[model samples]
Target chain A: MTALAPLATLSRRRFQLTTRTPRELLVPLVTPMLFALVIAPALKEALHTGTAYEAFVAVGTVGLLVPLNTMFSGLSVIVDRENGAQRELLAAPVPRSFLVLGNLSVALAVTAFQVVALILFALARGIDFHTGAAGLGWFVGAGVLFAIGMYGMAETLANRVPKQEEYIARVPAIAIVPWFLAGALFPITALPGFLTWVARFLPLTHGLALMRYGLLGDASGLEHIWSMGSNTAMAALSLGVVAVFAAALTAVSIRVFARTALR
Target chain B: MIEVRQLRKVYPGDVEAVKGIDFEVAPGEIFGLLGPNGAGKSTTIGMLTTTIRPSGGSARVGGFDVAENPLAARRVSSVVFQEPVVDRSLSGRTNLELHARLWRVEPGVARQRIAELSDALGVADLLDRAVGDYSGGERRRLEIARALVSEPRVLFLDEPTVGLDPRIRHELLEVIGRLRAGTDLTILLTTHYLDEAERLCDRIAVMHEGRIVALDHPQRLRHELGRELVELHVRDDLPAALAVLRAHGIPAEDAFSVGSTLTVPLRDLSAGEAIATINDLGVATAISAREPTLDDVYLRLTGDRLAPAA
Candidate 1:
């Protein structure tokens, strides 16, 4: 019971921070829809890939939304620290890792909700799930993996940066730039050699590839999977890559927070 | 119980904050750390609470060494920071519940403790309101209630009444007085208010420039000075007034003229006798005798007033 105390504290704090402000819930909900509406039509027209292009854009939009929402969740730590709540919690008996986990859980829950909503909106607009239930399940799994990686990375960055304005400025650049480079809206193959090499290392690039292949049967050849012909094998490989990234980043976040936040 | 010995904090850039200060608080004692701003009082609290590490020496709170067993120390103690540390977006009840959860209090016990502490702190009516809506004093009381939610054996309050109006400060002090009477909780309080320290502390440690210049019961400290302050308003010849007062057996070293007033420290002289002596000197337009207080003790020890310097 004592070991789980931190998790319970994190759970309650997540609810309080996420729900206390209407803007916290509303911004994550509305921002992705606006991006989808504005960017999907233009991308579809430019690529001339018909409805499939819209599906690609929807996957890309979810990729963007997951990290952005997770970053906002990570920023709550900075908010707590600035407002003195972090000091109170730090002085408590709970382990410092709980603060990172608590903030990440809130981010994951919020990202999951937004991803499902975006996918439903896409389905309403006639984007078919080529592999049906199996594909949709994999797509949501990929979204969760992306959210975990983003939450970890964002939590690490938020701990290192002391000022809120600096965090606010850096988050969009870190979140959106990788999102664009990950071939969410377009194929990374179109980029120059340097950027293409950089894109391959991004966790979102792998996540977007898995999501695209799961839902549409191909990732526009942006991602390389060992079993190219089998969608199941490809999804499994992508999940494996995302899992590694998630584990490594989460470890780093916890380690950095233990050193910095508790200090 | 709390024990600190030769505790030191030297921040980066070679700035020394707390310089080898030692003090102890027995169980259920209210110990006040009184000092002006930048006097290292906050730094001392920070070290004892495990928020800031000591650069040297040791501190133990509730039998746990602060540096070596910080978690154990934290488990036995709680701190109400100088700043508002509650989540303003949440209700005071939610904030207290969050603290209870963090401390791993059982649910039934937590609920009862929260209710009792809120009522005791006079924040029961404000518990359900968002802390953002609370007045400064209300927020401070709620912070204290939150700290109490853990039922810690020792509580550290860092300038608990800072930025509060006089009425609120007085009311909060009364609440603190009641809290001490009703519980065996050991409290280590830091403040700049000399009167508050005089009224509430069992013993007060006066800190200045990263060192404790004096530590004793308020009255004992004042009595140790062995003099009542006598201030005289002279119409003319301030030096002559000082010479005459000294000739009457007041210590010459204790006589000093400030502006138009001649201030002297009188030992073993009644206020009436001091007034008569001043009147006999024929140099006084107005005169007043003041009992020695913590303020005078602080001034004598630190050469600076307890209040913010103008």
Candidate 2:
């Protein structure tokens, strides 16, 4: 426990910040709901696919929540630089892993709330989420990997960019725009044939397919990808892809942050 | 407690921020780096504090090489950065507690140390308040307390009084003076303010353009010019006036001019004698003699006044 004290303190700071101003959490919470209220009706009416739209779009919105909340961790790092606290933290004798993991810890804690809220919203819409414990595990594992991998990208942008304006303009586009091209609103089949390959390569596309399959018990979304015969194989492959991506990006982000932070 | 040998820093693009410089601070001495902006004072502090790695050479704080083993150097030292480093969103106490954890201070001892530091710094009552609401002075005092929580062997303060109002700056100076007197901790501070260095530092290194042009005790740095200085406020033609004074048998080698003011070291003549001797050189508008100061020493070496940057 003593060895974990630094991480514990890092985790505790997020709640303290939330206590001071509950509004930091408010923006991320309101984001998915706003999309649901404003955009869901038009999209659902256009699809003309009864009830599948809500279930599909809800999972998509859940995808949005991963980037929505996790990206704040990167923004908070920039804010820390402005206030000079980041430099002091970098200068401390604590392990570098503590600082990076501490940020991920905060992102995950906030992500839990966003995930639950979206789940409740899906249930409220009369959407039946059909799955057993294994499917649920797939949903959990897919979401965690997607969150960590996306967070690494966001943090890398935060460290690499020198100007705050550039970071603000680019981080949101990188974080939020992927859900659009991926299967967030429309599945990959809806895209033009050339764009289908682009959508297939996006990590979120696979993560979203697994999450939608986890809840809806439909692997039709995963069928076109390499023409896999079974949903289990597709799910396993997607999990591997996202896991390797998460690991690679985590390694890259850690190296990038160390260079800018230490010197 | 702090030793620096040929410590240098060259930023990317071949821009040298700190040229090779060597200086050692005694175990318990309060040493100051006095220079104007762009003189590399903060860069020196940054390198010594291990925030910026030196491009060449080495620095050690508390016997650990900052570059070879930065973590060990960091463990035995803390720094009060030139800018506010406390988390404004957290309570003051939480900020100190977080620092304690970062340094791995034992929780039981950390609590007691935090209590004692805040009380001594006159911020114990405000420990639970958010740091965003703190006045500048309160925030600064808390930064100091946070730095001290680790019980570091060496402390670096980079332009500690840069943003404070004069009264708060004075009070903080007294607090720092009291702090040094009460402990054997070695302290190195960088400042653009001549008075800050004179009031707190036992030895002062006057830096100019990334080099330590003069290093000595504050009074001794001043003493390099003699006991007192004869200052002549010239109306115009500074060079002409200096030349005229030389024709009047004043040694041309010992006088320097800055901004229409001519300063000649008063070695062989009294203020009145020097005044009468150079009176009506036609360029001389006013003349006065006074005891030497760090400002005089800094100006002589750097050709710039070490004015308070704030």
TM-score of each: 0.89, 0.94
Q: What is the C-alpha lDDT profile of model 1 across B1-310, one tens digit per residue?
A: 8999999999889899989999999999999999889999998988888888789999999999998888899999999999999889888999999888888889899999998988888899988888999999999999999888898999999999999999999999998887777689999999999998998899999999999999999999988756687878888776666667777865535444546765566767777887887788777899998877787677666662211211
Model 1 misplaced regions, further than 4 Å: A132-141, A219-241, A255-263, B232-264, B268-287, B304-310
Instruction: Give model 1's docking category.
Output: medium
Per-residue lDDT of model 1, residues A1-263, tens digit only: 86876786777787777887767666866767876776787777776768777877887888878877888877787788788488888788876777778887878877787787888888887787686787777777887877888889888888899988888899778888888788877788778889988887787888988888777877554345242666566668778889998888999999987777643
Give lDDT tens digits, candidate 2, residues B1-310.
Answer: 8888998889889888889999999988999999989999999988877778789988888999988888898899999999898789888998999899888888999999999999999899999998999999999999999999999888899999998999999999998998877689999999999999999999999888899998999988887777777888887766667667777766545566688787877765566767778775656778888987888778877882312210
Model 2 segments beyond 4 Å from truth? A35-46, A162-165, B252-254, B304-310
TM-score of structure candidate 1: 0.89
Q: Candidate 2 residues A1-263, lDDT tens each?
A: 57787777777765566556565576777878876655776677876666778777888888888887777667777777777478788778876666777777777777877788778876886777898999898898889898888888877888888767788788568778888888888878888898888988889988898888888887866775547887898999998988987898888888888878766
Q: What C-alpha lDDT do the candidate models reach, one value each?
A: 0.82, 0.82
Question: For residue B81, what is the lDDT in candidate 1?
Answer: 95
TM-score of each model's chain B:
0.88, 0.95
Q: What is the C-alpha RMSD of each candidate to the true structure, in Å?
A: 4.0, 3.2
lDDT of 2 at A147: 88
Q: Any residue pairs clashing in model 2, and if so which?
A: none
